[model samples]
Target: MKYVILIHSNPDPWGHPTSRYTAEGRALSEEQHEQGDRAFDALLEEISASGELVTGEALADPASSTVHTWTPEGHLATDGPYAETKEQLAGFFLIDCASRQRAEELAAQFAGPGSVVELRPAMWSGGDDQ
Candidate 1:
């Protein structure tokens, strides 16, 4: 009944919105910022009303990503993420759902104009929190 919706970006696209933020684009102008706050409020209200959002967040840029892979040898460190192509995981949502269909319906509403959210059931270990 719980799922993680991984948001992915299209790599081949030249003007991907996720790729739009640069050093100069970090902070928006006053009007732009006001609009952003308004949008955030509306989005939060939508999520709360839907009953599909448990907790979610917009992630920091992928450039800040740190990768650690382990093998028999030990651990391997890398810069950024491990996306095969340009597409990368931008963010995610942890949700409790009644059915897969309902989850998918919720995903469709959340994706917006040019994004995809992959939903997968989560596995939590059964043990006392240490």
Candidate 2:
């Protein structure tokens, strides 16, 4: 089975979870920052070594995002993000696993103090050679 892990968080100066910029996220010292970085790196390495990581990436700032829609008159374009919320979609990981339980286990590592990780199965678009 193939799964996609969606990461979400509020816009942070240093970045979500890592909180490299904010004093609170820094936890009053550089030690917290380094530890957070290592934890994330370790998670990636663990998944990669297990051969479950297909691909993953962090997204750019949400303010730079754009939205498009069709109106009765014509097509419309607008600045995004379209949703109003404290948290926003930040990134994702694509993984191939043997079962949903396995995928869930992998996604658990990404759940942090200020971040949310969502696991969803990838669906085929049809017209496949299979």
Candidate 3:
């Protein structure tokens, strides 16, 4: 089975992976940062070695995102996400797992404090023809 894991968290707490703000933002202690990094690395290694990791990527800050809506007239573009929420999608992992339980386990491990991981099965895959 295939699953997409959506990673959500407050950007203020950790910023983007490449962000330079460590103190002005929701600053995590140095130790917390190191531990989180190690855990994430370990999880990725485990999944890759198990041949479950199809692909993964971390997203840019939500501030850079755009939302589009369709009106009776035409499409309209807007700034930011479609909804306002404390947690923004930070990243995602696409994995081929043996079962939902396995996928849930991976998602649980991927999610950290104040973060959420959502595992959803793809309704239609890229290669599938309707």
Candidate 4:
């Protein structure tokens, strides 16, 4: 089974959990940064050993992102992100596992602190051999 994990933030439990989901800063604390790096590093090692990490990447800073709209002439460029939301796209990973349970386990193990990871099967647009 293969899966794609969409990394997004979720509500923090204590303050304003409903309308106000506390946003984890794009910049992590020194300890958080170290912990994240170590966790991801271990994840990568595991994936590599299992031969399941097909492809993956950490997105560039949202501040650097370009929000563009299509125009008749060409692709129109704009500044900033694609949407205004409490949560934002952080990064993603694609992996193949033995089953949904396994995928969920991996996702659960790697999910960032105070974040939501949506795991789903990859869709195929064309039939095999297409």
By TM-score, the better pick of 3 and 4 is 3
Give the clash count for each candidate: 0, 1, 0, 0
RMSD of each: 6.9, 3.6, 4.1, 6.9
Candidate 2 per-residue lDDT over residues 1-130, each given as its tens digit: 7889998777466364435433445454567667767998998898899898999888877788898999999999899887798678888999999988889888988766566789988888763322
Please give the ranking of all candidate structures by lDDT, highest first, separated by commas.
Answer: 2, 3, 4, 1
Q: How far is 73's C-alpha from truth in model 1 (Å)? A: 2.5
Query: What is candidate 1's TM-score against the reference?
Result: 0.65
What value does the lDDT take at residue 29 in candidate 2? 59
TM-score of each: 0.65, 0.81, 0.81, 0.67
Q: Judged by TM-score relative to the true structure, which candidate is superior, 1 or 2? A: 2
lDDT string for model 4 (1-130, tens) is 6688877654443232111333553345667666767887898899889988888776654667888888889998888767687566666789988887888888886566566788878766662321
lDDT of 3 by residue, 7-97 (tens): 8777554466522232322356767767778887889999999999999998877878899889999999999876588678888889999
Distance from true location, Cα of 126 in model 1, Å = 7.9
Supply the global lDDT for candidate 1. 0.64
- The stretch of ten residues in a row with the least summed lDDT in candidate 4 is 13-22
Report the error of model 1 at residue 36, Å. Answer: 11
What are the per-residue Cα lDDT tens digits for candidate 1 across 1-130? 7778887765332232442342222444657646655765676677678786789876765666888999899998898767666556777788878888877766765553345668777777873332
Alpha-carbon error at 1 in model 3, in Å? Answer: 0.6
Off by over 4 Å in 2: 14-18, 21-24, 126-130
Candidate 3: regions farther than 4 A off: 18-28, 125-130
Choose 2 or 3, whichever is better by TM-score. 2
